[model samples]
Target: MPEAALPEPVRKRGRYRRRLRSRIIVSFVLLGFCLTALFAFATNWARQRVENQLVEDVMNRNLDASWQSYARSGGADVMAPVQQMRAFLIRPDMPDRLNSLRRDFPEWERLQDGIHNISGEDADGKPFSYKVGVRKTPDAWFFIAYDMSQALRGEQQLKRALFFSVIVFSLLSLVLGWWSASRVMRPVSDLAARLRAYRGGNAHPEPLAPRFPDDEVGQLAEALDDYSSRLTEVVQRDREFNADVSHELRTPLAVIRGATELLLARPGLDEKVLQRLQRIQRAEQQCTDLIGSLLLLSRNERGQGSSNVARVAEQLLESHRAQLGGKPLELELEGERDLVVDAPEAALSVALGNLIGNAVKYSQEGRVLVRVGAGMVEVIDTGPGLSEKDAASLFQRGYRGTHAGYSQGGGIGLSIVSRLCTLYGWQVSIRPGDERGVIATLTFTPG
Candidate 1:
């Protein structure tokens, strides 16, 4: 699609699934980073606030209890079950002064420090400064210690949730990608099917069903229709020209043949008359050959109806072999015998006949080898090898090599052979015979 044609918003909406997924991931990560940072900082600040409040509450409770005990019962067991009660506010350590008091006259001096904090942060093991609690009691000391291990663990769990979200989003991206790609290709695939039908000689491209009437692919389909129409026009014109030429030549060839035959039938012609008749006969023969060749060429160019290719191959081979007139040849038929091709019987026969005939004409005493395979017939001639130039242009229309001087009709046979081969979607090759002779081979392919 043209970039300018797509609006900025539409262009930004990428159809590429992988790129879309990557973009989603990047956005997710950015959001996650900002949220995680804000949340983590907020959580730490809230936790610190709660910890300070808890420490203040603990100090006030202990001081009140100690003062009541000393005033009412003269320093009774105020911090009853000291080990359990002290663990609530103090770490598993005691200063030298507090230890000495606990062994002798203990009246809650540890709570007298007035609630204070130790050096450390609540998470990631960072050090934090201390804070003192309300200093109402001179002998009591208060301390605060915050462990952020729990907060860190909570953040890790949040990270795990984020990762899980990413995975879910990625899967959704995959499904979206597949659906988008398939939708885009649907029109193109339909256009291709129509083009294939047109190529197979079915309906014209213009009449083919349009998959998407207003899309770029629809425009391509229209172009194909235009091109196909022009091609059909050119082909019809060429066929008409061929038919006209073929029809026009027939009448003159008939007159020439009739005149030549009448001259030959004259009774007891003198030497001069006989020579003239012979010349006339030669002229008639050339005219007949030319007319016949031209007619076949025209029919081939105009395209003949397809027939049973296997039957054509078999029948043409049998008839031509018999016509070879006792020429030494060996036939090798391999692959499937049910091989079928789309071509006229007559054109294929003429092409194969010419190839075989040339091989026999050049074979001398060596056996002519004919091999039949799937859509292919090869004729090998153990005769003079072909030159590089002859191999290249031997199949060209009316092209004849030096060897044509020795072959009949000055090598028109090979040129005709090539035309018929082309019409039938077959290929012909002439190369060194692998010994001291030439090899002429024909290979056919599915049209």
Candidate 2:
């Protein structure tokens, strides 16, 4: 079925049943990952900045010390200031040593008073990185190189450790989220389970608030208990009212039935009086059937019996025939007679009676055909065809058709029929006839 064609409550339920705990877990995981990622980025940035400043400072100091030592010794002492450092000096007067230094370190001849970073393969084809500080003087140029291979390795290990820490914390967050969600949802889940357990019977269920702590869940449970109590009271009162009304109305109807029967049995009575008495008896019977059906509807229960569709339709047609008075409306029953319904005669009577009554009431000079089939009965009327709005909402309570102007009815008969059909698992629908009037079908075998 199309989703738009589904009932409102069903559509709402389909849209809103997502799991809350799963949402909580996903939220925690994302939060953990983002926080850890930001922390790792900040830590790596700070470490890089501090390490570069410290290494540059040490290189500059060592280069200055080497320059001073070489100048004081008149370009004699060529040793580097730090153990992990190498120094080289080149003089403008010594062409042999200058040529050798230029050949050995071709890229470092453009010496200025600053620290520079260099990284490349060495003579042995091994990768090397260093910070080089240069000092230019009138006597010579000094170059001091500080090896950075060990620091580079340590930074790589730290980066690996940070990456693993992020992963570990993210996993820990996931586990913590799962545990927290479970703890938070436990009472709500229990409340739902207990509510589900109280599904069908038990008008007065156990109090849910007492079983939970004084928290949000407990408050919800308390509200539910209050609502349930009020709802139960309302339902109980409605059932009592229906029972009382049925009992009270049946007494007068029974009296009328007895009086009508007595009058009907009298011999040689006036034809008009006899017909009136018979009509009165049928009216009483109809009132009784309507009351029984309404009572069943109010209680939302189905009465059990075997009802012959043809017989009930025929009786309804006959009753409507008498009520038609001088109107030129012809009532007829057609089709199969073997169709039986697993519903009480009163329910069937009320359902079919409303259809036939509506047909008789609406048609002025045409026929009303009640056709019985395998698992369905159709009441076809040759009255003015119903409008689109009428056909759509004909069975809604208090809804009168457009053609029902000045009609002596409150528009509840068809609604009762609809409720009866629902209680008995039947389907009822009304539509415009092929040429004129309306066709109302009641199907006992609903899909």
Candidate 3:
């Protein structure tokens, strides 16, 4: 069968089952990554803020101490306060000191009374960074430079470490997500497997709740158990009812058959009366065949036999002819006469009978042809042409077609035919005929 012929619900179900587990795993991995990345960003920001505050405080305090020492010494002291600190002093009367300051720190003359950051290469062509603190009095000006090269190197090292930590933690998150996904999905997978095992119709299936703990999965299992119990009860009751009905119906049909046979045996029976009696016999036989086929369907079992397709078609056409009366319809049988099918006579009769009956019932005039070929049969009718709505839903139980006005049927005949085809591994299709009416084809060897 072509994929385009499959029902919409079947295709949607296939897509959903394939993606569910993978979607769960992908969700977990994404959540882990987002949380880890957020933490890394916060940690880096806080470290940079605290380190800048501490460096500024130390530079301010040292500048104040150096100016106080020079004031106490009566403007004569010129020594540095710390190993990483350099002090420079200039007075208005000292021309030589001003000239020396200009040659060494040219940009420092315009400094205000606060710390400022500066970086550049020295005379040795090596890169250096420092914080310069300025203090000015009416008598003298003092400048303190604090070297920050060591602190800059330490900050670079800390950044490198944090980068590696981020990589390591992200990888850890990936592994944790994978493990957690497996653990979470195990119970769901097990439940699905158990349900699949019970699909072949177990007489008494094992309880699922007992195998799982008292959680969400356990609740689901318990609910399934309740539903299964109710379904099993319903199916059993239906089977019993069908068996009882078939038995009761056969008794009356058998009596009718016996009465008709005895009447036909009489020597002086009138022609008209004999024809009526034979019609009664044929009706009884048709009812018997229908009951047997329905029983097999209810039991979901297949019957075994080999039947000649041409012979069955001819018999069906003859039966329909007797019922036609004054109707202007022609019934014909054509194609291969020796084609055989591997199915019971009653099953074949019920299936083909429904097709031929529908053709005769719907067509007002022209020919109803039954063509038998190798492994297949086609019932062509000059009935009112099929509509799209009828073609789509004709085989559904209780669905009457748009043109089925006043027809004496509950619409289950075609439904039964569809089930029989499924049980026997056969294929059936209906379409509009070439010029007019409908054509229904049934293939035994569909593969």
Candidate 4:
């Protein structure tokens, strides 16, 4: 079965979805986010380490000073005081408040040395944070508490700043990334636009190297210029060669056509001789039509002329019928009259001629019908039906069908037809007929 064609806009959308701009933007966003997040995490960790060290140092110094004052005062109950700190001696007869803390938090009493963080409520039932240093003498233990509420608030403020900075930097990175991508792609976009605007014919395009800086884009421009120059030379050589070959071939075909017409005009010719002359005439005509079609293809341009498709089909059928050597096959044309198409008569004749000729060549004793309708010409042949694989690749160059056993062809007939249809903005499709044989359809676009 033939595949359905997608709409042009949908096809373009699929192609655009994978464009480089989106990929570049996504890469930039991920990079910026990862870097900023790492920075924020490291900032928080460093701040925590420094703040804890300073708080522990302050608690240790104040605890040592209070202990020194108690010793100098000869173990006085009331010792020298310190700012934002309080010292306590834990004994069996300690106050209920201090006893309650040691009972509730066993870890605090278990501390042999060093500083610790403690969380609790004050007498007014207000939440508070503090750090403590525990010192154990021979007969007594000293616990010093330093308030940490201010330091905690400061840490919270720093954390808030770092969080906002991450958000702000990420957004800034996104903006900068978008701007950078636009700048990076500008030259490439310009190059593409210029390429799209180019209309190729006999003239070569302007050099693009001089228009760009000596960057990667500039190197690309230079490469494109060099390639275009070489390709132009190749196309020019091909055109000259085709023109020379077509000219040289025409002289011999003209001579053969003239000689055959002269011999056919003679009266009372033998039946065998007449048939041979007619066949020679048909062969010359086919050659001439083929040459014309090939030259048009080489030029890659549509010929400016209108021809009746039915008339062309009828002529092709008649020509094929002349070459059938006593074959029992019947050729018929069943279509609307005067179905004109906007193309040279020779091109149409060559295209339709190849189809009708193939049908006649393959069938031994069956009928071949050419039907012309609204915008289509279908050649229905009663030959063996084509396989799915053969139908898929039938139009490819040098690809013969599975049933093309010992056929005298190079497999270029359908290839030529397909090329001609493309040049003339037409479509050709081959599919198996309802039960047997193949139906080849040439659908022409209305101008």
Candidate 5:
């Protein structure tokens, strides 16, 4: 289907539903979330590194302090006191005890002076984790163990808290993102509202740049002001041009009509000359109707004039009947009566005339029917059946059909009809008829 067939309200609703505000909000939210998540990750990593360094430093200090205490006591007592730490003394001469140490940690007695995590159990048969250190003294060796289970458990708790913090802050980012988007979009929305409210022709639009901040939105407002000024000027010029042309053309057309009437009024005129004069009068009348319709279109206004749809169809059929040349064709008007429309007679005449004219032109030997009833008028033509290309682009301006070979038309007749239908809130569609013809429908709101 053509876009012109879609109701205006539906198109407007579709455009509104796809507003940029929602997209802007979503973009802001995603950006905030990504930055916050990255910051949280970096913070957690740095904290973990500092915590590990502090734990190692504390272990080394405890080892050094206990070693000094044992040396001061002259190695008399092998046990050195330390909080949350256990010290062991091993001699090279004690075979059974050293073998027991070897069984527990074969490499403990030969270890160097650095911290190492070891798995073990306390005397109470509870599993424990410890950071152990080994030192060589003058008389014997010392093994110092620092219980690390508490510290490891505290680290786990901190990890849980950090993960929870990431979640909380991410949620906060979402709220902040929504607020920022609203603030950013408010100016744009106001500008759009102002533009939509301004009507042309007599009312001037207010200057928008002064009301907005000095940013991208302000620049857009300034651009819109300039465009509005230029567009208004152009529209004014077009209105003046149309008025002048319509006036100039009408004067000559009126003279021709008057002269043709006088020639017809003369007594004892030739039948051939009378026929030519009558044709000239009809042409003059048609030119006047065309002028009125064009002026109305140029002004983009709809006027209310009650006209019977069937009566107009009948008159149009009569006009086409006279111009059929010698073709064996039949013109008929059918369907219900009193189907009035709320539009000017020239509007209806131009709209219906083009359709009937096209039917009479292409059709050679079959009946052309105009069916009028209710809120619709259907023009059925047994012309060369419409091709797919023609049916799709028929009403487009300057688009001639494949069967329009050598025809005396500029191909804007249907385009004008379509424009009139649009201006009057009416709908028009042209399609290939069932079996062997074409159908053009003009549907109007019921009067």
Candidate 6:
């Protein structure tokens, strides 16, 4: 059977069976079916018992009457009963109670060996059963036959009663089910309305209404409300953080941009001015890198969008290789297949770029081998690497190690990578460089 349509209450109360009416309906149907089956069994048992007793009574009576008749008349023909009609031999009350004379019922007559027979009705008034055939003495007989109109009438009454009961209870169940469903659905509908207001196209966590504090439905509402309210608080905190990022980054960028512009504006300014411009430009780049890392952190927090991991990684590696400027990054791809992950392509690029860039920046100008494991990316640089202190918190948001050296980014690169990896179920770990510099590995998100 097709499933019943979900009631409005279940939609509000829960995604499935959460209404009192649903439970009651299910329980009632099961109970009704079981009771009906049991009733049928009991009725059948009683009916069969009564039928057996009735048959036994008739058999005994026939045996008694036949023995008496035979003892009195040696082998006399059985008497013709009431109505005296020609349509039947033993009219009116045929010798239905006697077995031997049973064959002649509705048309009975004694036969040889003191036995006779007659026909009778089935449960449904259809002619289907045969009456008894019995011997009264060594050579005398009697028989009986009749219709089952009484049994048929009783069965008909039972069927009608069962039908009426089902109709009445079915209607009763529907009314009860509907009312119970509404009662269960009330709080849920109210909660949903409140949720729409709270979410407001964003995660605006709102506290639950305090009116109902301890009921089951109330508990659910309170939990959802608490979550929404927490969401709003978190959003506020993030806004503050993003604003702080902007304020912290503007000063250095302004200084570097202004210094570079002033010297470049005046054509052919001297060699000393040109050299100063280079340092300013480098500082400006570092400030931009720092700001970028902070922005990447926000994107990772929000799960902004998706990206093609394999394509993005390949592109970033190609760009980083060019910057090697003669020192090669020995590349090793562990698998023949490409790996895909649902993440921001730019964040992946920036993260991988930072690890490789750091390797190049800190190394003693040597080869930085990059290895892509089955589920990870490893960057091993040739430089005098970190101590235990540095490795412990190397990927902390702002903590830089003693040997981290001054890099373009303000220490947020590895942190962003770590945060993103955590959020997307990836793994990230680092150890001292392979007898050279740093070796950082980021396990890609499992597909």
Lowest summed-lDDT stretch of 10 residues in model 2? 1-10
Estimated TM-score per prediction? Answer: 0.45, 0.79, 0.78, 0.85, 0.79, 0.46
Per-residue lDDT of model 5, residues 1-447, tens digit only: 232232234366556743676676677667766776677678778876786687567666766766776677775554535566777776666677688889877767667878777767767998778778777766677777777788778777877876777677667767876787678888987887887777664646678999999899999999998998898789889989999999999999989998998899999999989877887887787778778888899899886687889998898898777777889999999997889888878889899999998999889889999998678999998988887778768878998889988989999999999889889988888878888778888899733
Q: What is the C-alpha lDDT of each candidate?
A: 0.57, 0.85, 0.84, 0.83, 0.80, 0.59
Alpha-carbon runs more than 4 Å astray in model 3: 1-24, 56-167, 199-202
Ranking by lDDT: 2, 3, 4, 5, 6, 1
Off by over 4 Å in 2: 1-8, 11-18, 73-80, 83-152, 268-275, 325-332, 355-369, 380-415, 430-439
Ranking according to TM-score, highest score first: 4, 5, 2, 3, 6, 1
By the TM-score metric, which is better: model 1 or model 2?
2
Worst 10 residues of 4 by lDDT: 1-10
Model 4, C-alpha of 219: deviation from truth (Å):
2.6
TM-score: which is higher, 4 or 6?
A: 4
Give the per-residue lDDT of model 3 (tens digit) for 189-231.
7998899878747767888999988999899999999998888
For candidate 1, give the lDDT of residue 286.
Answer: 45
Q: Compared with the true structure, what per-residue lDDT tens digits does model 2 show for residues 121-199? A: 9899998898888888787888888889999999999999999999999999999999988898889889988988897
Number of the top-ranking candidate, with TM-score as the measure: 4
Off by over 4 Å in 5: 1-20, 54-82, 86-148, 201-204, 213-215, 266-271
lDDT tens per residue, model 1, 1-447: 111100123454336524644554555555555665566566666766786687567656655665565457643334422222342222234476456647643433444446544344536766434343333334433322234345456656866665665655556555665666567666766776666655434334455425458668778877776777787777668768867876787677778778878877889889877866666665554444445545666555434556554465455455445445566655343345575556555566666667766666666566666666666766666766677777666665576765656555566777776666655556766667667566665666743
Give RMSD to native, each candidate: 13.8, 4.4, 4.7, 3.7, 4.7, 12.9
93-154 per-residue lDDT for model 4 (tens digits): 55674677667655677777778888778778987787888887765678887888888888
TM for candidate 1 is 0.45
lDDT of 6 by residue, 343-367 (tens): 6555566667677767767765666
Candidate 1 ranges with C-alpha deviation above 4 Å: 1-163, 199-212, 263-349, 353-379, 382-431, 442-447
Q: lDDT: which is higher, 3 or 6? A: 3
